[model samples]
Target chain A: MVIPVRTRGTTEFQGKYPEEQFQFYFRQHWIRLFMPFARMILITAIIATMGYFLVELSFASGTGSRHIVIIMILLIFAIVQLEFLIHFYNHCLYMVVVTDRRIHRIKKTLFITDDQQSIDLWVIQDIVKSQHGIIQNTLRFGSLRVEAQESLLRLHFIPQVGKKYEELMHLREKARHWYIQHQSAHPSGSAPHPTT
Target chain B: MDLVYVILVALLIIAIEWVLWHLFVSKSKGLIFPLETDESSFRVATPIRLRLFAIAHTAFLLTLICSALLFRW
Candidate 1:
């Protein structure tokens, strides 16, 4: 007998990116997400393991006092798991997408949902890649700082993103050329638009 | 029983550390520093706090083992 499993709501980011317009979508490095909480998890795990032994020894000594240690260990493990889950969820929810038309920033949390911000290519004043230290230089990954007339957004700790700066600049140049052409053709439609 | 428990605890702690090192700190693209690069090289590298925490973790484990041994004897 074969058992059938139903899988619904399995769609992956439906129609999020138009395939024809945007050729590539680069995600922020995964390392950035994990680094924030790695030490916390490791320390908690170590403490929990030590607490286990301490509790065992206490019980063995006829003290009949294992409650406090056991509770503390459980609390530590629970907190670690909670932190890991929160970090994973936050990482998965926050995303940035670049297209020929505009750049999209999507930020979401469990309860709070933020609307996407679309920044046109022509308005992007500068794209800066800051790589400091021998590690960042040697690793070839650094932070990308995006500057626009209205706002400044810094994409932090993007690993293996050295090559992306050039690619983005190329894309932006192309977009700027297209915008200039569009403006020359349609004077009325080319009015400076404010991004909300 | 105590000796067996102590050994098991030690093994468990080692296993946990190994897993954490492999999953979080190991030189994957997921880690801040790629495994190939030295951690000290990056400016936005793993913080000094993490190194200190690692030291404290090691010390805690050693203390646990020593205490277990002293208690057992």
Candidate 2:
């Protein structure tokens, strides 16, 4: 995914409307990157050891094929390096954002594709948090399934799921209360659709 | 000798990194997120650890390139 680098103040995000109040956002847990990172390290170590031995053997034997063998080893090592870059880039680009009016999931890739899904807080029907396995339990990270009437937004490996879930519940209640009050005040053709 | 080839490979890696950075990172630099804060009593601090992790990963790649240079020499 596309790599983003910056930090600033405000709840503001891309595509935020003037009337919308910014809330908080979160990405998949850092723990989710552990497997790919560990795999890269393991492969790099193995390749380095083998490459060292092969380079030394070929060099000491005074063979003309030493340079080609070294180049091949370097090429293989480069592949592992590229793999690490891709994984980290993807991790940085995937995130879920919450606003007073809506909850949004943004997914962007490094090339030409990106996707965003937004669900109005008022339309949220239920939120279920799931933390399976000893690792997720001990690490305090899990998945949240936000069920709307017609759509479901499943946020996986959310860091601090428990705390965020509580905050989300509070925001949803606030949004619903605001919606009800607005509807009562308008009471006619002025009220906007809940899905809008 | 083989050192020239190693250096060429290193240059290739740096070129690839630079091109990728120019294409993706620079173009999307303005995409900023609001600071993590609390409205009432609860505040969620920005994901500083994640940013640090990203920095560390960049450092690791640079190290890999350096290591390749040293290993050949």
Candidate 3:
């Protein structure tokens, strides 16, 4: 049986020179979403059950306070729901994207913080990954540290770190090869210098 | 007080819906990544969870509004 080899797929992203091709991308681990989501669910359940009993008790007492209790329950529910939504949106906005030439970290929030960081892949000197604790090891998410010639890029809680690390290493080699080929072909042209 | 509650709930619904629609449905300028680049024609598919959350949030808001209105009546 002939198995096909995996190749870097072509993807396009905005805010890049026309030639830059997307190689891979990933975000923080699923734990980022799961923790907050689990907390929200727990709080919602507590509020729901307690609110149900409280409302029933208040209604039995033939008091007008039941309406107030209902309103309070609804308010708390809204707050919890909003918190979960915002958290999910914030999580979705933060991503690490690798292209043929550069690695980019895009971070944005719904209202506040917007930041993007990039480093050339060809200049990357080392890529190291560490998985601490049993949770990280079992879940297959960890941190990756990329040391470039000038800058150090640290990504925490990267999902599927093992696979991502291998892919990144492979891409780095391809990027370096591409950089060398372009530089040698156009020694005096607009090709990006390896030293710079 | 109940009138105030109704107004607040309505506002919450509107605000949540607006945020969700802007982030997911509308062309969001804040998003660094493009849905699809013009030249390459390659597109990033939105995560299924995100899409599902958007739908679920809208449905939840609709249900909340209906319940609030029914209670008020």
Candidate 4:
């Protein structure tokens, strides 16, 4: 039996193998990052102006927890950037790892949620791409549903859903051909067990 | 003391970073490409992003610790 053990970056990321190859990789829309980033900018600007005034006032009065206020500002600054960092970490981690052998939807999250689902590329039954709503249509990022016999995995907020759908179909065809070739190369019960 | 509280909070943030790294970065880091993950579809988000972030974050933590200790509040 060929068991799969976690081999650092290779196994988890559809790598660490001889035959597997990656086709495409993408994350959710850039808007997700942009939204938070814009917010951080706006908030930082407000905080900076407010901090300057508060500091001036505290200095004039000579009696205020000005140090604490500065501390609070630093804390707020860190928190804002921290949110972006967390988003970046999560965004990069949770991804669609499509290999020649299988389509791996690895949902790795930091906040106590880790979901990893994989289906053989040859077994993919249907791939549906949808772009609804004004934002989705105008921005051109939407969702993809890869349906199989046992389960249906939906990748939401993926940019270029149409392109991904087409790629999925192509990969499916390639996977089918690869499987056929592999099966033909090794006939049933013709070779040794688990040696290859 | 307030300084103690601030220190504790800063430490908490560090802990969170550590946890986040182990939980997500270890499993899904796509920064190095072949160095990090050799798979075809799996690529790190950006090569130097994690490095830059770590440097900036460490600087922030160090500053925060220094403030907490020096400010006495």
Candidate 2 lDDT by residue in tens digits, A1-196: 1111222123466666666755566667778778988998899899889888888887877645676676577677778877777776666667677667888888776765577888999899999999999999998889899999999999998877888888888888988987898888886745543331
Best of the two (2, 4) by lDDT: 2
Residue A22 displacement in candidate 2 (angstroms): 1.2
Error in Å for residue B1 of model 2: 3.1
The digit string of per-residue lDDT tens for model 3 on B26-56 reads: 3334343333322211123344445666778
For candidate 1, list the clashing residue pairs, or say none: A31-B30, A135-B41, A135-B42, B27-B35
Write down the lDDT of every candidate, Cα atoms only. 0.56, 0.68, 0.70, 0.65
Error of 4 at A71 (Å): 2.7
lDDT of 3 at B21: 58
Worst 10 residues of 3 chain A by lDDT: A1-10
Q: By DockQ thresholds, what CAPRI class is model 3?
A: incorrect
lDDT score, candidate 4, position B28: 61
RMSD of 4: 6.9
- Model 4 clash pairs are A22-B40, A22-B41, B30-B44, B31-B44
Fraction of true contacts retained by every candidate, in order, equals: 0.00, 0.07, 0.02, 0.22
CA lDDT of A74 in candidate 4? 70
Q: Candidate 3: which stretches are off by over 4 Å?
A: A1-10, A60-62, A191-196, B1-12, B23-52, B68-73
Q: Second chain only: TM-score per model?
A: 0.48, 0.46, 0.40, 0.47
Chain A of candidate 3 compared with the true chain A, TM-score: 0.85
Model 1 complex DockQ against the native: 0.03
Best by lDDT: 3
Q: Report how closely model 3 matches the true complex, as a DockQ value.
A: 0.18
Against the hidden reference, what TM-scores do the models get?
0.59, 0.78, 0.78, 0.68
